[model samples]
Target: MTLKKPDPSTLDLSDVDWQVSTFESGGGGNCIRFGRKGEWILISDSHNPDGPPLVFTKKELEAAILGAKDGQFDHLAGLG
Candidate 1:
């Protein structure tokens, strides 16, 4: 079954439990918080909890994660 992507402006994020990695807990507020709601993955700035979040589909998020793990994004983070 395919899940419909939600409209970020219409989605209610009040009930979502956003979390940040422990490694970024002390990053001086320069990290992002992410949460999952159904098939949507939400990402928001840790410095602005009440702001609108960037939304992504489960497959999209998974691809990004896999790319990161493969060092595909390391250059963007200046790690490569």
Candidate 2:
């Protein structure tokens, strides 16, 4: 099957509110995902663009986001 590319518009990824993130396929270290519903996402806060992006199940990600909204989860991200 052909892999479907993510549409930026549909994802609504952007730098604002310091919450909700989506992973970018680039960077070396310091990758973290943070934020709330409607503002959900993943991202890599690094340089070099070598490290692989982290992965999270839709359910797990949604759970984490809920945890974040309630101030329960930390923002340290990693690949799964």
Candidate 3:
């Protein structure tokens, strides 16, 4: 079932249990961390732990995961 996308303005993430990806914890560069707030996923850069996060719905997150697995975003590495 598809869920409605939430309004980004209404989110309050003051108590999120943020976690790092296993790969990132193992000394991976370009590290990313994520947390959950209801059905939305919150992503942030590990290098800037206190920075603002990018929010994504579960569906959007799944699409991003698949795209990454398929190397659709490999070119992003060169942009750094």
Clashing pairs in model 3? none
lDDT by residue for model 2 (42-61), tens: 34334422333333345667
Model 3 whole-model lDDT (C-alpha atoms): 0.78
- Backbone clash total, candidate 1: 0
Q: How close is candidate 1 to the true structure, as a TM-score?
A: 0.83
| lDDT values for all models | 0.84, 0.44, 0.78
**Candidate 2: lDDT over CA atoms?**
0.44
lDDT, candidate 2, residue 76? 46
Better of 1 and 2 by TM-score: 1
lDDT of 3 by residue, 1-60 (tens): 877756645677788898876664446455787899987898988787667788888788
Quote the lDDT for 32 in model 1: 83
Kindly report which residue stretches of model 1 are placed more than 4 angstroms away from their true locations once superposed: 1-4
- lDDT tens digits by residue: candidate 1, 3-62: 677778788888899888677555686688899877789999888887889999878989
Most accurate candidate by lDDT: 1
> Between the candidate structures 2 and 3, which one is better when assessed by lDDT?
3
Those runs of model 2 whose alpha carbons end farther than 4 Å from true positions after fitting are 1-45, 74-80
Superpose all Cα atoms of candidate 1 onto the true structure and report the RMSD in Å to 1 decimal. 2.0
Give per-model TM-scores. Answer: 0.83, 0.36, 0.67
